[model samples]
Target chain A: MNYCSDCGATVSLKIPENDERMRFVCDTCGMIHYQNPKIVAGVLSVRGEQVLLCRRAIAPRYGLWTLPAGFMENGETTDQAAAREAHEEANATLRDLRLYTVISVPHVSHVHVIYRCELVSDDFAPGVESLETRLFHEHEIPWDELAFHTVRKTLECFFHDRKQGVFPVHNLAFTIALPT
Target chain B: MNYCSDCGATVSLKIPENDERMRFVCDTCGMIHYQNPKIVAGVLSVRGEQVLLCRRAIAPRYGLWTLPAGFMENGETTDQAAAREAHEEANATLRDLRLYTVISVPHVSHVHVIYRCELVSDDFAPGVESLETRLFHEHEIPWDELAFHTVRKTLECFFHDRKQGVFPVHNLAFTIALPT
Candidate 1:
């Protein structure tokens, strides 16, 4: 941060007392602007034998397929965020969402927590963020065209668990390769 | 935030294009400063029948008992944060940390991601944030004096699951009492 939000004073980067990391500290107010990773909550929703997927209308992966998910806003629980995202992206209401996969994407400073949700009904249409929304069976999933690794991992685990007749919570981490 | 970090200009709180919520958007540089919930990663470490606890030396709950946990820093995974918190709070190393409980405290804008860890060795001491560190058996736990509800929940789930012989990941949401 260039200036403190509290006092509008210029900020300096330094390690605070009893701290190991450097932070944007306001000289006047002594406010330490600490930046932490964000939580991205989403759901891998199901309807009959199909899984829900939304085609992105936004950039960074426009037209690519993904589950309905987005940034977890303040004052909302992770599951609440997931269900809201479902509505925002696909106009879908989720029910009985179980904690499924938690993935940490350190390089991007984001964590993905996906829930296995059941669609409340078949009434769903694409919201503004999605070009289109559809459901896919296991054989119809566009594996190579998926938007993110976390989504791929969650789907793979869901299918594997479904085949094995046990659905244990999966925790995984993904690190992007540093540019050489 | 008052001033934009990108251009040092005053930021206006407004809903950006297609965004549902208001964000601090810089008029000059067009930077949408979005804020999201953070993750607090910690471990419920065990050494045989005892679980580790650290008495806080910091404010907010000075001298109250808690697990070794803190905010998940940037560029590190949640597991790494848990491991680091273990070392930083209790001067202890951990291994075999399985993801146990995920609790979202939306009122505080934080999610607690806890793991069940094994103490690497018996050599332990308090770090700067902890006044004292000790292992507490189930009967000796300071239930009334715990620092946070998330810590209490994790410990309760651990003991309950231990008795049940089935350790499934628990997902819970805690709401702070709204001011009247």
Candidate 2:
């Protein structure tokens, strides 16, 4: 941050008194600007043996397949955020929402929380941010075309657990791969 | 926020195109400043049959009892944040950390994530932000003097689950009650 949002003054990175970490402190107002990891909430919407995926029309992985997910907004529960992402990306409604995976991506400062829920019906269409929305069975999933590691991991766990007829909440962390 | 953190420009609240929420838009640079909920991570550090508690030495509930938790910072996983909080507030080290409760306090735009862990040793003292730090048995807990609802809920779940000999992760939400 070059300027302070609170006072419109130049901000300098410095460790405040009684604090160990360096923060963006305003020169005029002395306000500390803190940046935290964000939550990306979505769902694994299922119908019979199929799971929903949306083809993104936006940048950063456009045209790639992903589970409907986005940065969670303020004033909403994780469950609510997950449900809203489903509706906003695929026009899908969900039932019996249960927390599934909470994956921490420290490199990107994101915690992706995915829920496993049943599709309300087979009726769903691509929302504005999606080029297309469709359901795919385990065998038909575009594994290589997946947009993110979080989506790929969640799908892999879902299919693996389906065989055992039991699903458990998974806590995972992702580290960025360094070039050898 | 009154000014853009990117450019030192005055900002106005407006909904940008293709967006549903009102966000701070810079008048000069047109930067969109979006705000989201933050995660507060802490630990329920247990030693024998007792859990650790810290008396606040800061504002918003100074002198009240609470678990060692604060706003999670960037470049840390939830588990790491929880561990850091315990050490920072109570000077306590933990082991066998497990995800416990994920509670959404939407009214305040905060998600409290508590982990259940075993205390490494009985040697713990109050850190700078804590007035006092001590282990408290179930019967000795100061229920009426608890600082936040999230801390109380996690402790309640821990004590109740102790009887069943199982500690399943909990997903919960808290709504603010309007005063009559």
Candidate 3:
């Protein structure tokens, strides 16, 4: 954001005449740049009573298990992103995929949208980004080793909903106290 | 990702002897880096027959109308993120927020998760990030001026579901071709 896209001039942070908060405004073109959070979508595909999970083969949290998920791309909707991730990571085709959860993690600059998908086929294998892939029954879930907090929370909610037979909708956030 | 986070040594993208894909592996610390897409969450708060919409005060699509939404935080669940965004952008408290849509926009690096929230209070003003805020009944919506394609699709789905009184439980992504 150092250089202005409009006029190629250096941008500076300043409060607008009518507003109190600071904004990155271009000195030459008067363009104000505003950055917003990105969206990530994925699917929690299930077969019978088992949930599908993928072990990462890449960085950030390599070797950790996660649902098949990815960032939304330009010109694509969130559901397409979820299905594409599932197809790419696990080689799974999902049907009747339902919206499961929407979690916002502002600090990390991401919002996670997870879906509950029914397994349409058992045909699956590790994609380019996966180290290993498999299914786990509820009791056999690797709760202690799940990769991301959002994935963990989605699983917890799924199990609870299954047990109660009443999927109570909720929107909540967990503030992670990162070590400074 | 080419340098080791632990020892600051050069890392290499190496294919495991037995595997097919390349992986970024640190020789000194044996750490592997894997990057994945992130999730985004937002809420569609409906009051009676009208829905809440906000004009963007930020760029990428500034001044266009959109749903109140943002990214998920580290420790929060999807539901939490949705509610938080609703409160922050609209100053509106929500109750019985239900999962509405999971859209994947892979080309843009995000998955958008939207929820249908019940507006608990009418007390609201423009948040720091919004240019303006207002409620629009179905017939009054500015369809052509909507900010994002995902937002437009979500609203369409909401109306479709409203008509049937039977919300389809599935993730759907529309591959939209935006004018460059």
Best by lDDT: 2
Output the better candidate (1/2) by DockQ.
2
Better-scoring candidate (lDDT), 2 or 3: 2
Runs in model 3 deviating more than 4 A are: A17-21, A166-170, A178-180, B1-180
Candidate 1 Cα outliers beyond 4 Å, as residue runs: A27-29
Which 10-residue window in model 2 chain A sums to the lowest lDDT?
A171-180
Give the per-residue lDDT of model 2 (tens digit) for A87-171: 9999998999999999999988899999999999989999999999999989999988999999999999999999999888899
Highest TM-score scorer = 2
DockQ scores of the candidates: 0.72, 0.89, 0.19
Per-residue lDDT of model 1, residues B71-180, tens digit only: 99999988999999999999998899899999999988999999998998889999999999999899999999999999999999999999999889999999978999
Q: After superposition, how far is residue B165 of candidate 2 from its true place, in Å?
A: 1.2
DockQ of 1: 0.72
Instruction: Mark the 10 consecutive residues where model 2 chain B has the least summed lDDT.
Output: B171-180
lDDT, each prediction: 0.93, 0.94, 0.77
TM-score per candidate, in order? 0.96, 0.97, 0.62
For candidate 3, give the lDDT: 0.77
Predictions ranked by lDDT, top down? 2, 1, 3
**Displacement of the residue B77 alpha carbon in candidate 3, Å:** 9.5
